[model samples]
Target: MLAIGMDLGGTAVKAVVIDHYGNVLKTMSKPLGQHATSIDEWNWKGVVKSVAADLMEEFKGRITAMGMSAPGICNEENTAIYSMPGRFYGLEKFIWTEYLDHETWILNDAHSALMAEAQFGAAKGYKHAILLTLGTGVGGGIIIDGKLLQGRNMMAGHLGHITVDADNPELDIFKIPGSIEDHIGNATIEKRTYNRYEATHELEAAYRAGDPVATYVWLSSVRKLSIAMCSLINALSPEVFVLGGGIAQAGDSLMKPLAAFMEIHEWRPRGEGVPVVVAHHGEHAGAIGAAAFAIRQSTK
Candidate 1:
């Protein structure tokens, strides 16, 4: 069977057509024009509708099952976004099923990324795993005992908001002080570096060139990330931790140091270590995962 998966992002809307075997038959992305800074100008509802319509038409309306990944809490029914504040106006309680004229399954983007990795990417065969998307901020999901843990509110996999430091007073959006997101998320780069660097990529470039300050900042972030992972290892004991997102594009610059730190911090009882690998699906993970998720749901 074939299905459609769509990821609604801040800047663009990505969609894919895929079969049950996880082969992507077609992929397309639509820019959401310029991002609106305020709620009044947040124009996304119409664009998403158009994108969905266009995709359906292109496939001659044969593709029926659809799934969406968005940046918010998805309802238990997976019909609409449950709650999302400060962006994507009209997304809250906006029913994709009603708008798209199809029964659409919706999931949080981070959770969707995990689903993609768990379904066909890094953690394909693993029954238990963790996925972390390290970009503008840290977002994560958990798969436990061969199932995605979508807590009571469908909010279980929020790994980024966990506290890493008690002494630090800085709070993230969730009001958690010194959380992992504050330490390693790209959103915190300027604040963490005292405005020395504006983005993680620039810091990584400087770190590569042997710049002392950049090296310090970059490694510090990775060290905190490793620390968080070690704590998670003790708590969840996932078989593997898959890393994704834009900052993860640093390749060995991020992985090698992270490995070193994990070796130092992670406690292994039998000397067995959990592997931390990069995500296989890359940028299209959300969309692909959404499609895969829809296909799975359809089969069920």
Candidate 2:
């Protein structure tokens, strides 16, 4: 029936009410208020309560279950956040379920995105799939045999941390170079284009004009992304790879080169040509996935 979904982002929080079919009946968003540099348990609980209260007030009894997509490693039960490397300061100690009704389900935001794709978007019919979202950072989700793979410690599908380059490493929390995120994230695109403050339109225009710098930058990003995809293809052999998030709007400009690279690098001869498709749901995938999770939890 109906469910409530919340996507807790670094800068903003998005909440939505959806039916079992993944239709958004109503939605709301708000800027994340002042958060401690280290997000303590109290602060984390407070934030969830405040946001949930706002949505619950409107939907009221219509909500059957609730799901939250946050940016860290969620506990196996999906009741608490175990770790969030750089962004969520004091989250390690927070038990999210304590802040909500016991019926709520919590999951990694990336996982939620993948669930959305698997349930209603690009990976709808695929038995195995991977969802990669390129935005402020690279986030990913993995599904095998039509089920989400929550590896040991519930951190299996963190595709962004996978190292693409060992020799020229991109140093991050894990000290790995050329992390998937480092190579293809929006921040990297902004840096490469030399338009840190320019909008996506300007960068797209530059690419259209055949600017050498922009071309090189764009291709470089695509190459890095393709390498990561090829690795995933070799490892998981998913039937489809769904790319979403802001940069994915580049369409063929990004997909064409990625396709070529995947063809060249993928190890599996039979599945070398796995389709790389854009997510139909776009930014709404997270919300939809959250809703789906909520529905599933309620049914249980």
Candidate 3:
């Protein structure tokens, strides 16, 4: 049988149809309708339903299960997002099963990305791993002892919001001081570089051009990320670390400096440093992961 995985992003909804083996058979994406001036004006609920209907019609009897991934903390029931302020209008606590007329599983987007990696991507075959998605903001997840760590409040793997510099005045979305996101996330690139760079790519380009300011800013961010990874390594002790999202696309520009810094900061007991790699599923990670989650849950 096949499974449906849907990723509800800020601008679009991405869905994938995959077989039991996790091979993708079809993919769909649609914009999230007109922009809403306020939460009450949002139209994403309809958009999501429409997308699901279209996919369901196409796959028909072949589809067996479905899962959704979105930007928020999933409730313990895995039925809906319990907390996601300032976006997606009616998403919070909206029951997917009742609306979609099917048994649907849901998870946080970051957790879904890590799930994709653990099931079929970078962290496949590893019992313990961590994933960090560095984009406009940093998102994270962890797998421990072969299971995703949802914690008591399902907020276990918010690695980016963890404080790396407690004395710094800046706080992240979670109001944590000097969070790793504040240091390296794309949202703070301009502020961190004194308005000289608008995005991480621009900074990386300037750094490649031997610009002193760009070099300083980029390396500093990478260093903070390394420190964060080191802290996670010590705490969770995952066998591997996977990096994904837009920022990880910097290739050697990001990985090289991160490697150099990790060499200095990461703790290596018995000379066994944790392996760090880029995600294998790329942009489709959330969709693939949602499908994987659905397939497994349905079988169980």
**lDDT tens digits by residue: candidate 2, 11-129:** 67787788888777887776666655754532655666777887788877777788888888888888767888667776664665665754678888889888888887889989999
Q: Best-fitting candidate, measured by TM-score?
A: 3
What is the C-alpha lDDT profile of model 3 across 52-111, one tens digit per residue?
899899888778899999988889988899988888777889899899998899989999
Candidate lDDT scores, in order, read: 0.88, 0.77, 0.90
Q: Where does model 1 exceed 4 Å of error?
A: 37-42
- Residue 52's lDDT within candidate 3 is 87
TM-score, model 1 to reference: 0.96
TM-score of each: 0.96, 0.88, 0.97
C-alpha positional error of residue 130 in candidate 1 after TM-score superposition, expressed in Å? 0.2
lDDT of 1 by residue, 64-131 (tens): 68999999898898888898998787789988888788888998999999999999899999999998
**Candidate 2 stretches greater than 4 Å from native:** 38-47, 190-204, 267-272
Instruction: Report the poorest 10 consecutive residues by lDDT, candidate 1.
Output: 35-44
- The TM-score, computed over Cα atoms with residue i paired to residue i, of candidate 2 is 0.88
Count clashing residue pairs per candidate. Answer: 0, 6, 0
